[model samples]
Target chain A: GAGVSQSPRYKVAKRGQDVALRCDPISGHVSLFWYQQALGQGPEFLTYFQNEAQLDKSGLPSDRFFAERPEGSVSTLKIQRTQQEDSAVYLCASSSQAFSYNEQFFGPGTRLTVL
Target chain B: TQLLEQSPQFLSIQEGENLTVYCNSSSVFSSLQWYRQEPGEGPVLLVTVVTGGEVKKLKRLTFQFGDARKDSSLHITAAQPGDTGLYLCAGGRSGGYNKLIFGAGTRLAVHP
Candidate 1:
């Protein structure tokens, strides 16, 4: 319960369809991150948010991927015109501080499947 | 791009045996962390080594960071079935965004 929580544990989207995944970080966490993990591969950074501001999004694959933490507490990752290559486990993690290398707590993640 | 490489992609050992996994890289890192991930679950951080040549122990698990900060290792003494999982090593740079670069991971299977 105190850990990060992700909505829609499983998602299936057809080609060219749009999908949105939501994440609720632990209460009062200042830093939140989104990662993409393909089968048999390690989790790769997607984007990071410090409060309401998105400081880095270099890991996002393409323009079709967008993430926002409007209120700084809850964030959403939206993928438009999804492709089969986009299928992966989307994970959300949160840490206490923005600068230090604090331990991150991850959620169960949303398994996205693009057909 | 800074890359972390883990060796012995897969290891299957009988219970009570000892095994070691390694993570190597060319670029120095500010900190290195080890995590264990089970099926259908997120990874759980086991330890973080910040200082170069640092060695940390968590129960039967031991972690070492290279003096150059470019590599690290994880050793399990007397592995057990519960220790079976995907072991990952991640590196954090000193400046700019402290984004973590993860290794490919070593899948360990401890059979009883």
Candidate 2:
């Protein structure tokens, strides 16, 4: 794809259920970011990956939230024991450069709904 | 806590009208970026200003960074309905970490 792509555009899960969202960043992008956005708010950073390395996960709300990028081109965010508050749009973005000066390309995002 | 605060959380205007959104913070940043996000889509980067007191223009949108690097403003000239979306401001400090802190965001609605 010419741009970042995410799978499972929308997901519905019952409370306490687990869900996984996938992200396919633009080819050759070395920097990938995951963010969670509640309705009517800005995105909150979840994690950051520099190629295959997961350098930061400070924004993950709890231990139940986990993310990984084995090959550096694709990433996944897994949430366990979901709660109502965990329901939000999960977005993934990729940048060509390793520094903040680079522009980021974002995916459409996966909207998770906890019933 | 929100590192950045955006004023006028919501704005509604008729097409062709002009408006401005503000992003403020107490901390200094090395660079600031603005992004616009549509419904069901992720935020798309609009502009990035590295130097304080810098001003950049993109078509009908004009962005200004504060001299102190603690604030910024986005001005739109003759906004159209297509301009309706959520605007976000993010700041990153130096030191190579490059983790961006985002503001609460401003939702703009332009009626045609």
Candidate 3:
């Protein structure tokens, strides 16, 4: 159980509702990443955090998507005014290295269903 | 946007069969990684190839990176039912960010 852990393995939200998915990376991991995986597709980068500092968020689908990591440990991805398009799985990953080309350990992911 | 195109989006074969999945792109990558994902679970890294024209083997799986680093392939020999899952290829940039550009993935099913 040393790998990354995500909360609310499954979430159901109505359109226009707000939802927050949490991610707890492995201890001592310096790099954390969030990705969105649509049904039948691979995961696409959503955002990245390096020890509480959010470095890159170019992959965020829209301005409604926001993520924050306080104290360099747990991360929370919040979707404001949820849309039906977000009805996919949100994945969290962590790595011990500073760079991304290194190995990253992923969690089971939080599957979100927006109605 | 850099895109990775995967071939044979869905593949089905009997046990003890061989198959190959490919990921191609026009943009060059600093490194390429292969991952296998099961239902409701996150992807697990299978292999990472940094050097162009490099080939790495893991058990019955063989991964090859293109000479131009713009493509890659995964070949499974004598696959078993346990091999059934979604195979994905991801391209990483050299900027030290973990933002990965991933292919759509190849869903493989090996029947017994």
lDDT of 2 by residue, B87-112 (tens): 99999888655678889899999999
Interface RMSD of each: 1.5, 1.3, 1.1
Best by DockQ: 3
DockQ of 1: 0.66
Q: Docking category for candidate 2?
A: medium
Every model's DockQ? 0.66, 0.71, 0.82
Q: What is the TM-score of each candidate against the true structure?
A: 0.98, 0.97, 0.98
Arranged by DockQ with the best first, the candidates are: 3, 2, 1
TM-score of 3: 0.98
Q: Give me the runs in candidate 3 sitting further than 4 Å from their true place.
A: none
Clashing pairs in 3: none
Output DockQ, candidate 2.
Answer: 0.71
lDDT of 1 by residue, B16-77 (tens): 99999999998888999999999888888899999999999999999999999999999999
Q: Which has the better lDDT: candidate 2, or candidate 3?
A: 3
lDDT of 3 by residue, A3-100 (tens): 99999999999999999999999999999999999988899999989999999898899999999999999999999999999899999999997875
